[model samples]
Target: MRFIIQRDHLVQSVQDVMKAVTSRTTIPILTGIKIVATEEGVTLTGSDSDISIESFIPKEEDDKEIVEIKQPGAIVLQARFFSEMVKKLPSDFVEIEVQNHLQTVIRSGNSEFDLIGLDAEEYPQLPQIEEENVFRIPTDLLKAMIRQTSFAVSTSETRPILTGVNWKVENNELYCIATDSHRLALRKAKIEMETPANYNVVIPGKSLNELSKILADNNEQIEIVITENQVLFKAKHLLFFSRLLEGNYPDTSRLIPNESKTEIVLHTKEFLHAIDRASLLAREGKNNVVKFSTIGDGVLEISSNTPEVGKVVEELKGVSVDGEELKISFSAKYMMDALKAIEGNEIKILFTGAMRPFVIYPINDDSTLQLILPVRTY
Candidate 1:
């Protein structure tokens, strides 16, 4: 196998594929990246059983040559060394040649490295998804959905299902919901489906995090294909596959309050800033809890007190404060996370009661919501 590739393109592809490569895989070949050079272009694949990423660099993009293949073949090389070597190569171009017995030579301006390569035949084959269902979403929308919801996935392993984001598609809309029992974030966006799809699948949070990073912020549409046990996301020239979590995700509908006992409309940044400041003191406290209270007419006061440290008092003038006045305490970290996810000038906070869970969402929009369970302060 012999090919000459632009270093810039090769480096970017290597970084994307390396996200799925793990050093501790039980299969020895999984630690290596498989490179296949063909007449059309070059394909780079890396996997660790749970997730796989394939990056393709075309021989010519828009009439510009990115790669030139002398002999079409495939080889698997150690990802750790090969990926680093490409980045540090002395020139803007890279040449790779595989000889008999899997001897590989990588050369650049004034630098030459010889690596022992493995037969690409030993690498596990990427799953060929028949794709009974496929949906298309704008790249920007997909990245926003991931950022808005994936953060709330449970980090605990006690309930393995909560560690994944619940993806649901129905009525031409896609909804992603994630919760760690204490806080939940849900984002919804309209999608066009080739056929109507009603799939409720739980995808591991880790996988979505990697996918979000791989995607660029552009108008390009990403195609999502779902089978029974796996999901594939095709973005630009890359293909990402992840194994779906096995268990059923818990129904989160009942958790969101139907109505609110107290509601407040406040500027998003102002509220976020108050909570961020109040959190400093809360961080020194036992539970990192901050208190919120509605005062006469229009004042909202946020306070945090720690016996060992000090107290913080920050007030914000709300755009409008209505409903029954109430006081509630919740994790400062959770509030900040929720506030960051909401996009807009103003935000609405709905509280069921002092003890019941409350929801934070952008005003005048029903698409995104963040729910938080208040912490008891005794």
Candidate 2:
């Protein structure tokens, strides 16, 4: 392929696609990025079987020429070297040309480098997901949903299904839930679509995390399509594909409690900071556990103790306290994560009992909820 392209466009496209390329990939061609130049524009593709990302740079945008294609062709170049080289190129434009035997030359501003390229034909094709049952969501809301739930996914692969977030859409409502058995995050939103459809799929937390990072903080709508084994996210001039985890995600609905023994309304930031300070001592303990207790008269106490380390106790006055007073112990990290995910100044926490899982959510908002399974300390 022979093309002269703007340096800024080239760098951004390379970085976007590079998210899918992993050096640990077994496939030789997957280590490189496939570059194709056509009459329309230049397309860059990167994949590692599990995930694929494609970015397209138009030849001309807004009546300005971004790329001048001398000859339309395709080649694969090592991702690591090519990405690094493109960033350091000292010019506003970069010229790339391919000669016989897949040899490629890059030149920019008094500097030139030759790189051995791989045949683009050998690269694995990305999954062709039919665009049926597609739905759209605002980019910023999608990012928030991912942030609130993906963190709750299990890091251990013991129960592979827990490593992903469960996404369910039914009757124009989308619900996302993630849990690692110890803590759970749930968020729900209403969506409008031309044709109503229902779907339940498990998306890898890692994939959602990467996609969130790539998406800009905007209100632009992002098209999403889900198939039996693959999911596709389409944005302006970009396409992302992720392989679905095979297996039924456990039913999490039954885990949320219907009743509470104690309920407290407190400030989100106050609770979060208390847990952060208490965790400092809990971190030296075996399970990083923090103890929370409701002392009477709308007063709450947070404390942590480790025999080898010191103990800490802090008091927080709640806005409202009702039901029976109780003491519960839970992972400090889990509580902090739940607190940060919730959006609002004041939060309501519902405790079923000292041992059962407790739910936390923004006051006056039922759309988002966080549940934590209290640690048992005798």
Candidate 3:
């Protein structure tokens, strides 16, 4: 295989595909990236069994030649060395050629490198997903959904199911939920689909996080295809696939309380900042716990105490406190995460009781909800 390509386009594609390549794969060829040069364009693929990425660079786009393929062939080269070489090449263009016996050579302005390549036939094939069950979503909205929920996925591997985010689609609405038992983050958005279908799939948090990072903030729409065990995300010339985790995600609908004993409406920024400062002292404490207590008419007190580091007390003014006045303790980290995820300026906190899990969300938006389990503070 031989091809000459533009430097910037190749660099970007390499960086994206490299996200799926792992150095510790049991299959030796998985550490390399498969490059296929055809009459249409040059395709690069990277995979590690759980995830796979394919990037295509067309031979010519908009009358400008991006890739010129002299011979149609395929080769697999070490991702680590090849990506680094291409990025550091001291020119605006790169030329790659694969010779007999899987020997590959890359050349640029005043620099050239040779790498031992493997037969592309040994690389695992990417999962084939049918296009029947496909939908499109704006890139920005998809990224927002991922940011709002992926963080809440359980980091513990003991419950493999909890380490992934649950995605459910029905009636033109898409819902994403993630939980670590102590807290939950949920986001919903309206989407367009060609056919009506219901899908409940659990995708690894790690995979979603990577996908979010790769998706740009442009107004372009991304196509998503869901199959029995794999989900494919296609944006422009890039395609990403991830294997779905098998098992029934725990039913979390019942965990959200139906009633509240106390409710408070506060400015999002003010409350976030107060908790940020309070957490400093709480971090020095045993459990990083912060306490919130409602005072007379529209006043809320935020405090944290540590035996060795003393305590911090701050009053956030001009907040509406309704229902029974109550004090509750919760992880400062959890509260800050929930606050950052909210998009509105004002937020409402609903507490069923001092010990029950409290919910936080925007004042008017019911589509997104964050729940945090209170921490016991003696």
Candidate 4:
């Protein structure tokens, strides 16, 4: 493949594709990034068996020539070296050419380098998705859904299914849920559908995190396609595919309580900051536990104690407090994570009891909810 392309466009596309490339794959070729040059444009792809990302750059966009193709062909280059070389190139444009016997040449301004290239034919074919069961969502909304839930997924491999986020669609609403047994996050959005979509799939949290970073905050609609074991997210000129997690996710409906013994409405940032500060002491504790107690008169006290690190206490005045007085202990880290996921100024917390799980949500919105299991204090 021979092409001269703008360095900026090429750098961005290569970086996006590299998100899927990993050096630890069983297949050696999977470590390289595949580049193909055609009359239309240049395509770059990367895969690590579980996820594949493809980025395309057209020859001309907005009446400007972004790529000039001298020869149409394909090659696989070492991702580590190629990515670094492309970034450090001291020119606005770069020329890449594939010579005889898998030899590759890269040139920019006053610098040039020759590198070994692998046969593109060796790269595995991406799963063929027919785009049959397809749905569309706003790019920003999709990113938010991922951000609000992906963090709560378990990192352990013991329960492989728990390492993925559950996506369920019913009655034109898509609900994203993630939990690590100790804490859970849930977000729901109403989506207009052409036909009823009844897909319940689990996607790895790592895949969703990469997708969220690649997606932009725009009004464009992102097309999603789901097959038996794969899910595709298509946005503009980018395509992302991830393998679906096998096995059914545990039903979490029974975990949310219908009644609460205590309820408090407070500023999100204020509560998060208090927990963050108190966590300094909690770091010295075994469980990193922080305690919250209702002191009446719309006041909530957050405190943490460590025999070695000293004790820290902070009181927060909320908008309102109701129900019975309660004191609960929970993971300081978990509480901070949930608060960061909740994108609102005001937060409403519902506590069932001192020892029971509690649910938190935005006071003005019911679309997202977070639940945390209290830590036992002995």
- Most accurate candidate by lDDT: 2
lDDT of each: 0.94, 0.94, 0.93, 0.93
**Regions of model 3 farther than 4 Å from truth:** none
Candidate 1 on 1-378: residue-level lDDT in tens?
Answer: 999999999999999999999999899999999999999999999999899999999999999999999999999999999999999999999999999999999999999999999999989999999976789999999999999999999999999999999999999999999999999999999998988969899999999999999998897999999888899999878999999999989899999998988889989998888899999888977779999998877998899999888898987788988899888899999999999999999999888888999999898899999999999873
Please give, for residues 210-301, the per-residue lDDT of candidate 2 as tens digits. Answer: 99989989999999999999999999999999999999998999999999989899999988999999999999877999999998989999
The pairs that clash in candidate 1 are: none
RMSD (CA, Å), each prediction: 0.9, 0.8, 1.0, 1.1
| Candidate rank order under TM-score | 2, 1, 3, 4
Question: TM-score per candidate, in order?
Answer: 0.99, 0.99, 0.98, 0.98
Query: What's the CA error at residue 127 for candidate 4, in Å?
Result: 0.6
Query: How does candidate 2 fare on TM-score?
Result: 0.99
Q: Give the TM-score of candidate 1.
A: 0.99
Model 2 CA lDDT for position 252: 92
lDDT of 4 at 128: 94
Q: Which stretches of candidate 1 lie over 4 Å from their true place?
A: none
Consecutive 10-residue window with the lowest summed lDDT within model 2: 188-197
Mark the regions of model 2 whose C-alpha exceeds 4 Å error after superposition.
Answer: none
Q: Relative to the unseen true structure, what is the C-alpha lDDT of residue 30 in candidate 1, on a scale of 0 to 100?
A: 97
Per-residue error for 14 in candidate 1, Å, reads 0.2
